[model samples]
Target chain A: MGVNGAYACVVRTKVASTNGGKPMKDTIFIKPGQMAIEDVDKPTIQAPDDVILHIVRTCVCGSDLWNYRGIDATAPHSQNPGHEAIATVDAVGSAITTLIPGDFVIAPFTHGCGHCAACRAGFEGGCLNHDDNFSMGAQAEYMRYQHAEWSLVKIPGQPSDYSEDMLKSLLALADVMATGYHAARVARVKTGDTVVVVGDGAVGLSGVLSAKMRGAKRIIAMSRHEDRAALAREFGATDVVAERGDAGVAKVMALTNGEGADAVLECVGSEQSVDTAVQCGRPGATVGRVGVPHNAKMDLRPLFFRNTQIAGGPASVTTYDKQVLLDAVLRGEINPGKVFTKSFKLDDIDAAYQAMDKREAIKSYVIVD
Target chain B: MGVNGAYACVVRTKVASTNGGKPMKDTIFIKPGQMAIEDVDKPTIQAPDDVILHIVRTCVCGSDLWNYRGIDATAPHSQNPGHEAIATVDAVGSAITTLIPGDFVIAPFTHGCGHCAACRAGFEGGCLNHDDNFSMGAQAEYMRYQHAEWSLVKIPGQPSDYSEDMLKSLLALADVMATGYHAARVARVKTGDTVVVVGDGAVGLSGVLSAKMRGAKRIIAMSRHEDRAALAREFGATDVVAERGDAGVAKVMALTNGEGADAVLECVGSEQSVDTAVQCGRPGATVGRVGVPHNAKMDLRPLFFRNTQIAGGPASVTTYDKQVLLDAVLRGEINPGKVFTKSFKLDDIDAAYQAMDKREAIKSYVIVD
Candidate 1:
């Protein structure tokens, strides 16, 4: 253990011991009886390319909820779900060059070996490495990371005095916050342009803030809850339209002089939200969507005839834009960390998830000691 | 008309009498009951900015049937319906600069003064000049055209020996053919791209040809009839999916690699065609629609998520890209005029309209002489 952070943390759940009946080695399992908390033997550095990070903070995501609910069964029980975490480098293998022990870092959501074509193209999500996929999920007490130089962003200051809000927000830099920034930037928000954001989730609220920081003349936040809408306003959403779909389009039109908004950010994954985002723009408008879709189909006629364009993809956070966004946050240009509405100790993780699932909290953060 | 080709033959149509039965007046009444063809006192040069054209060749359009059937009840029926014509200049007013007497020309479907700001922006269809508003349809004997320099393109060759096919094809540039070109171009076809042309009428068929000329790799023509499909193939459509809306999209997808087309052109004014065009594109595709939609209610969801774009307007042949298209046709690079499937004398115009309306012919032409 280091200074204020004491004791080595273990993430595995306890199991009943049988007297000499059978010897069992704990391993990650997806059986119905085995929840994500099921104990797995501590993972050691498996290769010279690996660096172990002691996760200091971990955040849950909408996608993690899908895995938990068994909706997105693409990789059933394949691995743990958490992809957003802030940590400190505990150890580096012989080959790891840039990162040393005790360096605080925001781990990339996806890990790349940094030598492949995709990594060269800055798309770590599509990294071609066949041997190293563990650098992605940063949820455990000790997470092994490959390609340490590219996978880690060293927090410039020590963690002892860091504000909980600022530290919790760095979890967003792992994925959600950066994803929203990518969406807004890709939509080409210009000065004096009207921007509409669909979804009032953490990513959406972040987009509202991002659009404002991008100099949008007006930012309209589409939300259902009073609290989220109020947060959106506090984050610089100039208008809020609570309607959905066609009615939402009409509301946007009414506000935009019968012409729709100039840009739209679709941060929700639902089909209805997607449609509303496109319809809430004027001719020659653009919509940037970052929500990972499940089974959404598309129509081209409206987009073509109205001269609207859509641009979106997975958020490549550390791909040349991390410093830009980091500088903005450091200078207080955006306060994306404000989305963390609830906090819990590492011991009460289940309660944090329960609070979030009940819609009682926009986001939850678990701090490690 | 001097030397047949030298003097621009034109035609003019005017109300024979006013609603008040005033004796010979400058302004006349235009009512459905008063649509009798009458010899009005011939038009004299009205302004220094005018050019009197002798109507040499004129043809009817499918939209003309709408007026004759009283479907467009507010369109002022007593006014002529013909907009496609080729003519020769008989006289030029003092302010007429580029156009002179004895020049044969093609008067585009729209009549624009061409000097207004809107016209300057290549939106002659929305010209602001008073006389540019349907001053006279091309079905008459002589036409006094304002803004002659901007509204007319000098005929490339003599009209006397012109084949009926060539003349009919040339006449197409005045409207539908150009509209099809606009639709296809807006759809943004490129090499190795699959395109779906919705609508099998003249404009749609011409769109098939336009897509082919624009290097579309696989042209899927959606038509209801075998004859139109055959014509579409002749015009270079690689495939013909004789279905509508969703089914048509399935057929296109089946032909493509389970992905929809890269481009879709909606040429029919029906909501069905609009939806079908939208459904027939892959993610990040475009659909171009040029039809004047009779009624269109669209869903905007697929556009935002799938990254589809849409753009279109009336065929601004008088002010946009028509010269480039005309040059291509004159060089036989593409022959969209083949859509005219039947012809009739002006006296048999009723039969011509019936033929097209009943689907007995793809398109009908009227020989004014």
Candidate 2:
């Protein structure tokens, strides 16, 4: 299913629901470039660790556009596709102990077993004991949350306890916020550094905020879109570059006194974008590449000669959300939900995807309660 | 003129000699697969920073094999090719103040102004105030060294002050020793880490020593050569895997309990070698790639998805040399010179190149005095 190509790992192991399946409205990928909200069999305990989530808040992600834009191919004609959600725990499997019915929680995009090597090392995104597709079908009335004991992060209270804006911010912790923070962390963004954030997309804007939080002295954002550029500035970008490729590199170099950036976050994974990201780093800079690499290859010799290091991958949603982002959001220290520029009802999920695909919205917030 | 392909950055700034060109025994690259020590015009002061060195000892580097193996094209058929040297400061330039005549010094491969942004940041390899190159023609009776004030590392006394073994040890500091340390530095090899050294040459063997010196808990040297593998063990390798490609990856994985290495040093710049090095790193691991990449391209998507960071370039000879490597050598803490398995007189330089090209010697030491 198109939970977006980046998070579209499918599960082959299917467990029969212990009860007769009830009907519910859930999002599904009908085919490339098309999404549908239809009546489907409501999720139930698929495993001992599974917990049924009554989705309170769900949204369309930037990655969803990859599938809606007809980029990735999948074998199934339709698969329940969604990952981000703020939800109420409706049912808990017997083995699940950390989560129970009526608990207010945010379901991270990735579910990691707490005991895995990657999880213990704080890289839950690469969890070796992962179900690979455990958290899909999240944009619905009810979705089965796997690894509930560890993957579901409990907020203080029910969704009504927070304002609409706060809920949006909490929803962001499910994916993009952590993803952006991952980029900065992997690039080793430290205090007093000059950071270059490529792509003015939601993640890129989030990266601007993350870099700022990491104590970067100056942040240069590469973006051509005016709205995104303005948002980048709001997110703490010191400079915005509209031109791309060599021209973009020239602008960053000029701004950095021909030395380039101390840390570069490559938030757009195209060849041109990645090339610009690498070229804009200083002699000993590290570039954080978090955008789903479409068909980009790093020119190794150039990176080698320039002494640039590149580090990144899928975001450790569980790791970051549990470790810091949740508390930061709760304390109103960050507003990642500002990226959700538009809104749509759960039935209008297709339009949300279209808005993002057409570049009309940085991200689309879905009202799924 | 054949110092090797990697050091063949041709300098176009021709300097006129005040004295009628005096003849000295020097190496010149005649063609691919050939090297010669001929009576050629000795180097003279070309810049204010230039100082003439009475070459006491020099050697062939792994990079030189690039030219000797018929790689990298150049407009000029003959250019002085050498970067590593231990010599006596025969003459000081007018502007040079940091060093004086009769002082024994190690000439680092890359000469930096010591005040450029890159140099100031301890990455002299990417020094902005570089002369493109300033330390070529080092394997000669007498050579002109540029950036004399900061590039020359002074030993305590004249050449006679050190034993033959100590002199060889000091000479290794000019390139290989520091280069090996560079891989570890860039990869962030830390205490209790499992490091993978991918290459069986002098630099790779030196990487084993550097990884050990960095407090790596386990050092895995990927070597097929019996002699080089033994040297790798002597240099602090805990494991030696003679397999290559997929087989090599399996071997390393098995040794690390299928977790792969914490740090990987890509000392061999070929595509196959690089791929092997990358696969041997655990999730979220960093690979230090110091080999001169010859027609090698890093598959960035794989690197990004696996959360691997690739960091490295030309070794920061000045930074590591001035900071720690030289002191380590002088203290008799490391024996990097042991990689020099064979020695040749200045007149037998051709045989030295032949031996290295055929893998008969890990490195060839040249006694030019």
Candidate 3:
């Protein structure tokens, strides 16, 4: 099949007659903004610990925008793109004893084998036994999850008990929400700390919630967009600075009585955003950045004089344990699903990308039937 | 006086005959190898808690070379330099209670007032009551120390008991040794961890010792110079990698079975040095840099992927408490003075700078008596 016209073919090929010949399912891909829905073979258990997931919901992430915007040049053309996901167990391998068919689970962006050194150390994102990222795109109808017992977290209570909003919030635990929590955790945000979160994206908004949950007394969100800024306040931001760059830092410093924030959360991953986050922090403060850094260079001279520490990386979402976030959602503690400003059907993936790309949506959810 | 020819007017001026006539002293200055030794008005007790010291030993630091090589553009022409010193208390203010005449002390590069928030928090380098750096040059015969009680660490026993080598070693604890300790401590170098020290300067050599003292099992020192590399081994480096940049990183990775060191001490503040330190560390590792960063920019992209934390600043030498190091010196446990490869009389300050600037000396000491 030609790479360009491969998506046009929806032909289903039967691999095993004994299993009633499950048909291949369609999946979305994009080269920058160009989208395609291609029929791919249904995932079959290749390992004893593997599980086949029938994806129910998936969401676009700011990191995905990096590839969609062609910023990540190495991202392959027609590459399957989504990672944050909620799915039902369609099939489980012999060794997968913790989960069974019909179980709802949260699939983290990265999955690790249970026994890897990194996984054992609680940094599954850096798992040695795995490639340290999701093998299959979760935007698809079906995904083959390796080391499923360790990689997928079963949602608490029955799958039928969750409302669409609750499920969306729980689904956020897969990536954005967990990533924000990692940011706050790494920054060592404590009670009464005044935190300044750079970026008003889904991750940044989620950081406000995470910091609040961590007992931060004041959460300052840096945002230029009115809609996102309002959402940031709703997510527990005590203040919002509308400026950018030096002026933004100045505003935060003024708000912080000229000492800068006690902790900074850099969620945007842009050079400017990182710069702002660093500048908005006080002496001996830590800036935890979860953004997939794009040409971001932190000037060590200034940071050194201030004794500032920069600590963060890709969030080990699996280590965060989705059950905790799911429990929080069930108790109405945090509504992370508020970030899902737009929604789309499986086939209308183009609209989802457009809304996110054009800044019309904070985050767009894809509902798969 | 005009800034250019100000140093030429070095004629000593006698002041305060009632307190026993003290003549103004000569001090050295350089703007990119251009040297000058000029007489300046002697410092007297400006504050009630100040103490005047007669400097006995002072050292040239690698950081001073940044200004001496014309790399630090902001460095003033004929600026009074030198901060590391061992001195005898010449006079004390009315409010001074820590010491009287004849007491020997170690003067750190930065002094804290001890009452500020940063000082109270053990970050004396970021003291709010002071300018966060040495107020007087230590290379001169006489210097005034503010916040004397908190800034100067008194030498145990008597001034006459310390040998010249012991005094030099104790002088090192004021800056280089303390800075190295800060680097290792911030990097979280635990027992049995593999550590990489990224420079061969006095600070780097001291870092090797500090790491060893901290119980690091394998310390890798990155150095190309035969003499410094040999000293690195003496300072407890288990391995020495002479290559730089990618080759240096490759060597470290090869030594660690492609996993990289658990912690990296960046004792060189150059961009390349910082980059190598970041690359030489494994996932969840940290790079503690205290080399006075000059145009050092940490690329956050690779660091983010590796989950690397970069934490460091000017070593709060006072916070480390020189008493701990002094006792170690007294017990002959660690000889940090081994770093001083060249010595000079007070008049030969230019030669000291030359030896350090040309890398002929790992560190140079000047006898001020």
Candidate 4:
């Protein structure tokens, strides 16, 4: 078996233990620009419908940098750090109906009650009855997952039945890949469309994969990093626009024969990236955005004049997990796991965050056993 | 023949005239809050692909108030005053291959080249090669029209062949009805959807008609004016909200079982109206905005979290005229003309503006024959 997130193994036990009032060895923590692997009280079922998940593989997300890099203020330190996870149920509450302990699962990061208007409309991320505490970070030995009866998807077999790559791919369905797919889906990318993806992050690369899968004839990925650019091409990018801002728009317009792309994906939320994404749409085109808007103040006036639409938001991971991405991943039809370029043992998660912060890895995967 | 705008008759002659530097009774002019009928040089084919239209009927648009009511600045006085036109082609330039003299037509206000990306994509309102001079005010004896070979829709028969009601319906297709339809179309209003229309203007009433025609199970029209509310109901609104701002949103939510509407049409662009429009959308709902934003400064941040898409712009009248509405009007399936509650003779054009300016009429109709 591959250890430390090359592939994390299956969960088999539930332990009764305490942190002993010290930073032990299993969970991750973050305080502005710094991170650590610490011990925390092992989770138990906290709600009637909740379950305790023994996380198999957990990975760092780009949004984690919002707090870790000081873009968003947080407490002096936070015990919770990651969101994506491929896990096995360790405990179940009385209200659980569909899921059972020891069932391998991909937990949708934003726990959703599938009966809500949003979930029924295919945007489970905006579920009306969501409980925030259900998504306690997955970067630990155990975490509470609510909405298990409706949101969590059971994987087909035990961890040993799949390869390391398949494990990481399943982990991706928890957030990143689903988010990228949302961009393409919302933009209504169609066959023979020329699409522009504005960002070089793992999410943007995943967006390139999504557009190609949706039948876009050409995908132009905006990336300057050699490694990310290569991966973007591997994900089906037909061209790369290394420039940004006005220059980047000019490059896209030139590439599209002065008309701009039929659909544009805005995967980075800064004002610059969003503006660039909007600028790259042809008249009657749409810009699908997935980045958490940290500095975005969009004015709808210009979009109104061009007949361009701005759509998409946080990915409905549960929708994608049960309906699309998981099946594709298991069938080896896609390899989104390549996005996890650096891996660490749970004890070395601080290094995982540091590598991603320094751009040393596209994403950091951590194994907790 | 119908004497004035409840149903203006066909154009029989193309007049060659001199104003003698005096205001005359044929063409309308506006300066600040005042309006007058004036005479100007009669139009002639100005470009190779142009046509001179003998205007039969025209009207005051809600947007005309932007300049008359001082929301938008104007040149001391503007000779051009209206965009909607139901006319007959008086002359065609040498390059006009499809149109002939005396052809009854519905001129799409924003002239479009049928082959441009915007036109091909069904958003001819954003046509790339539009000429400013083509759509000179149609509230006159004649106006110069461009892109005649593509954008102008030829009505099926002579003006006299249709009843007064049919004439009014055909005229509605010029702008008002098509615009409201654009809002519904862009919002993707589907069967069984609950639609919210945010405005009391003629366009909003038309939107009520469109939502119903699109099979929406319930249409909530936000209108406080008793007369407009009655009109909204006649156009198929299932509910009426007589509140503004937050109250309007609240009423909509309650009517929708606290989940909000599946699609919202922002037909008025005041900040409060736009805010109400966005607030009325359920998660995954779309807000289609067609009003020219005089005071709208929409922030996309909140919409991002709700998965609400804000789309739409100027109506692609050419697209709708040629593809759907005109045919429906001809078959007597829809009557968008009831929006014209007040009519005036060409010489009473000032009264037309005054009545609409003071909200005495939903829209003012003028006849020029």
Candidate 5:
């Protein structure tokens, strides 16, 4: 198998222990920028369709930075901080089907009951059965995923054939890549259209790749960071606008011959970012935003007069077929893994968060050992 | 030759007058609820593509009430207020084509140059050559229109075939009807959509008509006014929710079996109206608004999680074919003119404003003699 083979073979065992007779595991949390690794009772399978995953790889997301920066006040303090992850099934509930121990899978950012109306309609992110407090936080060493049959995507190749880089690329499909794909999709990025991706974060970089993959002729990345800009180029960004606000809009307008971009991916959720995205879009174009908005309010007058559309909310990652992106990754057509610039052991997540918080790393991956 | 034949023979003649040798005419303005009729230098055709219109029939718009209520600060004191009108083409500029003096035409609320990229692309409201200040204001005895060929839609049938009611109905097409149609079109109102129109104003009632005309199966007008509610029904609203805000949203949700509405038309630009519109929409639905928003801002968090879209700016009335609505009126398929409950001579414009401001009239007409 591969590096994860041994742990993947471990089957679920009924163990009597403290804390509701469940085994305990380590989970990380953050109170603003301060990190803490605490021992928590391992999540027990409560639903027959639940699967317990031994998280193999998890990463810090741009949204996580929102919490780290204390911008997301609603995010409970000491809340488990990760959502993007790859894991191997360690246990399956009695009613679980189509998955077994040793199977590697991609855990989506949000899980949903396969039977809920929203879930059936492909809006798992808005799942009726979802509970933010109880849902799987992939940052944990052991995580319980509900509706496993519909929530997890199986890795196509055998563990032996999966390269480290390919595995990282597949992990991105769980959140960033899927979210980026959603932004481009909702913005209705058409072939030969010029797309502007606002923000130089991993999600914005992924948007550049997604737009390119979706057949856009030109992809512009708005970035101030040299490293992220270079990475954006590597991900198929044809141009980069380092300026922000009005200057950035002026640059984009000049680039597009004053017609503005055909589509704009608003990866940053600030008022200024939203303003720039709307300002840089041509009339009748759309600005698809996936950023976790922080006190963001769009002034309707400009948006109205411009005749541009704003469409994008929390991405329904499950609505998209993860296999398409995975297939592309497996075929070596794209390298989304480049967004992960550094890696840390699960025990060293504090360093990982610090690296990301200080902008020393484009994104930090936590490898479970 | 037609009802307007008397004015047809008055050919274009340059007459030396008081203010800078321009002809003087009476126009109306308002300082909040107080109205005044003042003598001002009549607008002259300043552009080669301009036309001077003798205002024949003009009506108060729901938007005009915004200025009357002192809600629109930008509306200057003594500023001309009317935008909805049907008029006779009195004079054409040197370069004007496709229209002649005495042709009865519908003056769209906003004018476009007809040949700009935005206008050609069917977003005339965002036309590059558009000048709100220079564009015709229909409250006056005489108004100047630019890009006359594109800005004015000729009244198709002979004036002899037009009844006063039919003429008023055609005038509705200039603003209210066109705006309502634009809202429905942008929300992507399907044939069977259950649309909720939030507002009981003429525009909202017109939205009911427009939605029905666009083949909506069920339209719910959120109105507290008995007359406007009846008018809404007459315009094909299937239901009327007298409640406002959260309760109104609940009523709509209850009506939709708790699934929320398929589409919502936010005709009231207040925060409460926008809130109700967003709250009453089902996931993935759209809230199309045409209200002149006063410091309005949409909270992005709820909209994002709901996966609903908010689209609407100033309606691109030119993007739609006015002839279609005109034909509907001509054939007696619809009676939009019924919204005009009162009329006043141009000399008594104050009473027209008072009637509309006090809700004594659904809409008020100003007859220029």
Candidate 6:
């Protein structure tokens, strides 16, 4: 019995660049409101640490609109545009030890190899990769993943029993949902802490859910759109302010007994959003912003004199904390996936972008059916 | 003797309301480089916690220039325009306990009662006050300081042979020197950490001294002028970058093995200064900005992805760490007071402002004599 306990683990079959169906050749890219589906070569395990994932389902993101309009200059050139995906491992490299073919996994929008200092310190999104700049984006048929162990979350079993809505919501654990949580976490929302969320888009809505999970006593969602405000309420917003600037600040103060919210999360990255976030905070409060601003200008005097602290960085979704958040969702503590209100077929990707751009949907997911 | 330690100690003096010379009946305000010296009543303490300081040496600041040009709307309606001053305790109220008449002291720009939560937490600059917005500024002939014990730093007893230069230099501790130290500390300049300091003004020059005291391995001073840059080098700047933007970042990178500096101090609050400070930082580096930014448009994507943290506030000079910094100055570990390059009589105050505005002097002190 002791000898059997020390037996070597059997190796699984590798999907070596060879054992595949006439390798699927399709990739998606977005350009200024239009989606392009073009034929492309299938990706292979390029590095020892990389694993090939056959994308099972992928989704549209609010951030995609920036690249759809060519605003995010640093955005990847043309390979793939999606970051959230549920996938099945199709291949493993010889150097890979933790993953095997046939494992069901969720891929984070941004992946970092597990060994960099940043990754070790739990800031995986800022990993120091010696071989690649853009590691793994999920909008393609087959994606090459770096740091397979850290980047992929193993689903205990096939999630066939889960509804598409449930799966799509879980997809947010890859980025948007995590981004919202990161914003709330950085803002240090505590029990009885008044929170003001700027922006009613997907991340902002998700932020309402996040603040609620963090035990925020009152969450004030600042939005002009009726639909978004309603969605914010559904997601646990205790109050909603439709006004902007001094009027909005007045409304927030009125709701908080003349003291502003203890924390403000700027989910939209605009000059207006930043200014709004700053003005909504009480003295010595913090404002955590995740909006990747196209052209951002922050006046430091208001922030300094009001004793405001601004802290938010790219969400480290692939870090160790992702598992904790995933468990939170499974435990019914939060349903971040509620932000997705629309779904579409992968072949009809163009409609997904159009619907999001026209504000017809808050968030859209594309099923690879 | 044992009971005496537990009992409330008492010290009393009947201080006159005036300095015995015409009551100094002039208050000055500036508008777009224009000075309006108007006759106003000499300021007196109105709150029980307030103590009056007889201004002996007050100096002009780069921040005051913003008020002169009307860029800071929050600037007092009739700006007295000085925040750094050495004064003698002129009067005190019954509620005031620590400060007494005849004590020579340096009054910080803003005052905080030591009992507030913010003061207890060492961020006295964020004190929640019911009486006034900011404690009375240290300009004019007399200042009404709130929270006397917590707001004033008594000067060490003169060795009976202390020189006038030594005293004025000590006065620099009231603001610039302390602020510079605060910025360096917030940036967390470690031993062997490469630090890049933007701006060559009094605060920037003082930052160099502060960095030296913190044991920074390399100090890069960013300045455009030759004289200021030379002064920075003299004050312990190991390298100087005269360029701005990508070129400046490249120079700093080249100096630091292409990784960039570990810490950057942004002493100027403009958008360009903030960006430059962000640009000079390496991954996991920090940027501490103390400038009252006019318009600071910081990009969140880069800041987040690079894992750089930005932290700063109005220097809580008289708070927890002021004494620690002051002791260094007294011990000769730092001589930041050398920054006082010009001095003026109270009648030559206009010339003092002109000199600072024109950048003809780093710092100009107005002596009561």
Clashing pairs in 3: none
Screening candidate 6 with a backbone cut-off below 3 angstroms (N, C-alpha, C), the clashing residue pairs are A32-A68, A169-A337, A297-B297, A298-B296
Q: Candidate 4: which docking quality band?
A: medium
lDDT of 2 by residue, B262-282 (tens): 889999888898899889987
Candidate 6: tens digits of C-alpha lDDT, residues A1-369: 000111121121222345453445344443455665655556777778788988877777777666566554222335445667888898988888878898878777656676665565455656666424233346657777776766778765676756776677677787788888878877879998889999899899988988998899999999889988998999899999999877888898789767577889989877777788887876667788777655454445656665577777667676633557878766667777777778877777778878888888888877773
- lDDT score for residue B23 of model 3: 56
* Candidate 4 residue B236 C-alpha distance from true site, Å: 1.1
In model 4, which residue pairs have backbone atoms overlapping below 3 Å?
A24-A39
* Model 1: residues with Cα > 4 Å off, grouped in runs: A1-369, B1-37, B41-52, B75-77, B91-95, B111-136, B144-148, B319-323
Residue A290 lDDT in candidate 5: 83
| Candidate 4 wrongly placed segments (more than 4 Å) | A1-30, A131-134, B1-30, B131-134
Q: How large a fraction of the reference contact set does each model reproduce?
A: 0.09, 0.64, 0.63, 0.74, 0.58, 0.40
Candidate 5 has what TM-score?
0.87
- Highest lDDT against the true fold, candidate: 2
Q: Comparing 2 and 6 by TM-score, which wins?
A: 2
| lDDT of each candidate versus the true structure | 0.66, 0.82, 0.77, 0.80, 0.75, 0.71
Q: Lowest-lDDT window of 10 residues in candidate 6 chain A?
A: A1-10
User: Against the native chain B, what TM-score does each candidate's chain B reach?
Assistant: 0.84, 0.94, 0.91, 0.92, 0.90, 0.88
Point out the higher-scoring one by lDDT: 3 or 4: 4
Please report, as a value between 0 and 1, the fraction of native contacts recovered by candidate 3: 0.63
Ranking by DockQ: 4, 2, 3, 5, 6, 1
Clashing pairs in 2: B1-B28, B1-B29, B2-B29, B4-B64, B5-B67
My TM-score estimates for the predictions, one after another, are: 0.58, 0.94, 0.85, 0.93, 0.87, 0.74
Please name the candidate that would achieve the greatest TM-score relative to the true structure: 2
Better of 2 and 6 by DockQ: 2
* Sort order, TM-score high to low: 2, 4, 5, 3, 6, 1
Kindly list the per-residue Cα lDDT of model 3 for residues B136-249, writing each as its tens digit. Answer: 467688888777877888887665788888887988888899889889988989999899999988999989999998999999999999999999999899999999999999
- Please provide, for model 6 over B1-369, each residue's C-alpha lDDT reduced to its tens digit, 9 standing for 90 to 100: 000111121121123345442344333654456554443445567778778888877777787676555554232335454667788888997887787887878777657766654565455666665434243345567767767766788877632335667666677777788778767877878788789998889998888888888899899998888888988998899999999888898898889776677789988877888888988887656787877766644446567656576777677678623657667766766677677788877667678778888888888887762
